[model samples]
Target: MSARMTDAEARERMDEITRPEKPFNRFRWTITVALLVLFFGTSLTVDISPSALLALPERTLFYLGLMFLPPDLSEVGRSFNAMVQSLGMAWIGTIIGAVLSFPLAFLAATNLASKPVVFAARQILNFFRAVPEIVFLILLLPITGLTPVTVALALGISSIGTLGKLSAEVIESIDPGPVEAAAATGGGRLQRIRWAVVPQVIPEIVALWLYRFEINIRNSAVAGAVGAGGIGTLLVREIQLLRNWATAGTALAVMVIVTLIVDTISGRVRRRIIRGPQRPVDIGADTLPPDADRDAGPDLPNDPGEAGPRTFAPI
Candidate 1:
């Protein structure tokens, strides 16, 4: 058969093997084309034409030059102080969000609360998320008087929705075994939550709070630009109000350096929190080479001593 086959037949077989089963799926092609149409159609509606895109790089370069070519170091001390203030704002905001969200998360969790309560809690969280931090800041301005504290309050309120939603998810995904065992032992709702739920969720929840802190750090700057007193305010004032490019550059540099340091430290802590203590590995006789014990080495014995099931205990 090999010698009898024509070259055309072999080529045809090779082509068939390489070809896809459905090379031109009408549904997939239609969907892709529809998405493309929607993207371009919507982009056009928002006035994002080709001409604007073509000039974007030049416009960006103009600002980049203003920020970094020769930053003024005269205001380094003041910029550093403002950067510290932003950090404080972020820290306080995170604490507020963590405290407020910790309880609401339980309420929103289906396993932890009745359906009605969960639904209501979710609705409340949704309301918080739907409103932007800027809006909250604006509303609170009259009361808080355009201070960094107001920025912190806005950030905290905005964070509640996100933190609560995530914490609820973590709660829902916890081990049911512990919860069931607690209930079996006549553990009341509070007892189950305290023993089973809190233990399992605390680490992840803390990690979430840390991550939120990192986000809030960035957000604090933006909030400051909107009338609050922080590095962001300094940056904006220099760039737009005072037209002091050198001063703006100094503030921008300080903000970047401080933010990077904070993010690095926070990320390390979050990773360590998530990856808790690991179990130590042990050697077993079954896997050792035969005659190893007799030859100043170890051998796998037929009757290996039994060790009870391993359990993790905190140091």
Candidate 2:
């Protein structure tokens, strides 16, 4: 003989299954309130007012009118040359940073290096990352004497911190199976990294380098404000000294157009790198016998002499 469950008991069991109880997060609410208070406090400290914001549109329009009314065509050649220099500086800087960061990334990676090594490498990267490219340019200007080379060096050194940290994170997130397999096959430290890690991380690292190159172009313009040789130098000279607003506007337009073009190209390349090569998979083919020699097809090399075993050199 079975007993029937009461309606209240059934409802209680259904509630337990369907709607699980959640804990009350007092700390989360407290933090949200604290953040709200801090935001208002900072706004008050900065003396922000609605009246100033209300006047912004009129002021901006006035400046825009001054800049683009006649649209000076006098310095078009000079602006183009300076823009090219900026691109060169950015490209060279990114290359230098990529070269320097590649090895340091392994040291900062937790999966690859000891705690002390990771900590030390991260601290070094942080120091470089904390300093802005403009500051680096300012310091190097005295030694390098206001050349594009100085701007390149500044951007390169500043880029190392961010690049190394991102690369270390990428290295740490890779699957551990390949690394374990490499070790099982008696590969040494460098050999394991070459065979198991470099192939996985190199594409992402190269994409990061291209992304940084786009950023460095803008930074190079900023460096030009301090006479480090770029379109920015032309801009400052025209607007601040000569009071040639139209020329300055032309330079600004050139900067914007070049940056947009580079960004578009780099973005497409990055997406391609991330997505990788696509191969169509056949479900029917996948159901073939497990013992089938898939590599023994006519398309594959039949003789050992035709296809030697692949080998990877240590980095």
Candidate 3:
């Protein structure tokens, strides 16, 4: 038979389970302190009386209840046209940016450019990215006489900087072995780039281009503020005229549709590119072995026998 445990013994066992000296969770403690400060600061600065906050949900419900009424489908045709125009502007801008940035992206990537040139090109890309697209829209309106074309130009210019920087990074991060192999085999710079570097990075760059198209769509929507033409101009007009109901409806619809379409399409495209079949590498019959080129007779008249029947050369 065992002796019955004392109360002190049971308490000691419970204390071991609880571990009183264990450290507090740092993340949780930090979050608690942050919330306390935020609440105190908000209380001190804002005129958010207890009554106002308590009644806030009621006020919000009133506005949402009004929105349940059917949207003014009377202007459906006009709205549809405006949306189409906005889409067209976005499409054109994305095309221009994607096409124009290819060379710049290559130039800015150290793998493709001379070391010095790439350094300078990267700085130029950084400078362009620092300026907001809206600023470009504002600057170009006066010069180009305010049109969808101006918006496209502005969006394209600003996009090139961001696209180039991202593309360069992708290019730079690729495996260097294939490129080195190509170069060591007596391939010229262009040949090495075409066969090795481009093959690895093309899928990623194309994915980036598609992603940029989605972003351009959003940028175009907001470019209308500076007379760069789009649905934003109509939305602005509605707001300025105190058509709050119409403004609210349009704003909500735009937010929902753009978010849904961009997230769905970009996600699908990214997955497809990542999982796509890679380009097959062809080992040419005429391609040189690594050391074969070094043994080739110096550029002088040599007998066919001396050159070993010219079995290998750079592909």
Candidate 4:
């Protein structure tokens, strides 16, 4: 235990440290075997041969040359309009999801809702997450009849799962101080959530919405290919049906450029929201109830006072 030890003592400590038997590297071996199995299984399933692998690069280059040799912009106006439609669908979907997910988040938060409510809300979110957005588009296609609105609705429903789940997590992880203060001031459950919970989580939730919008934009492109109405439909038609490489290239370029612009703007806005004008802003702190601190006084850590059986305190 001394700071300095004799050589014999050091040797004795080393032996003691190394005395336990080392366990087998089962985790490493398991990972290696699983990866091998997956690689071989996928290769067999896809029937990819050594010659095909070697020819992949050459084939890719040949295709690229065909598409972009003299990229045409004859239908540039149409591509631009379709891109706007895709943007519209994405925005509509994001708003719908944002609106729906907000309430579900509260219901799903363990700190806010009862066990039954939480369970039900979470199951709803899970079902949304489990199914792809394409499936929802398919279901809505018949009723809505192949419009951007249908894609928007599908994306909205799809967004609920992720938004709800993430928002719930954000709700649960908020500063407990605000909740405690609300309770101490005799605020009921709803008041506590409104005054305490919303302010803390709103910025993050909005940022998440923006991020989801970026995702929905991409999803819109895929939906368009399946007859939802966007640049995707045009791009696919030019390439597959018309075999017009120039037009296809133009459409593809427009889609990429537009998507990138949206992504860049959204990312900047999300950063601004997260890193607010004041990080962890305490807006209108003067409004806090004066009597709660004065009348109650400072209680011991274990005190169960006006805020009956206090679970959280200001940090």
lDDT of each: 0.82, 0.80, 0.71, 0.82
lDDT of 3 by residue, 234-265 (tens): 66665556556654565546645765677588
Alpha-carbon shift of residue 140 in model 2 (angstroms): 1.6
What residue pairs clash in candidate 3, if any at all? Answer: none
| Candidate 1, 1-315: lDDT as tens digits | 676768899898887786456677899999999999999898779956788799999988897887677767889999999999989889999999899999999999998899999999999999988988888889888998888999999889999999999889888878787788678767799988987788777877888999999889888876655769888888878888988887888888899999999999988787666764446334466465676667742222222122222221211
Between candidates 1 and 2, the lDDT winner: 1
- Give the Cα-based TM-score of candidate 1 against the true structure: 0.80
Off by over 4 Å in 4: 1-23, 47-55, 278-315
Error of 3 at 218 (Å): 1.5
TM-score for every candidate vs. truth?
A: 0.80, 0.76, 0.69, 0.80
Evaluated against the true structure, the overall lDDT of model 1 is: 0.82
Question: Positional deviation of 96 in candidate 1, in angstroms?
Answer: 0.8
Residue pairs with backbone overlap in model 1: 292-297, 293-297
Candidate 3 ranges with C-alpha deviation above 4 Å: 1-7, 16-68, 242-244, 247-255, 277-315
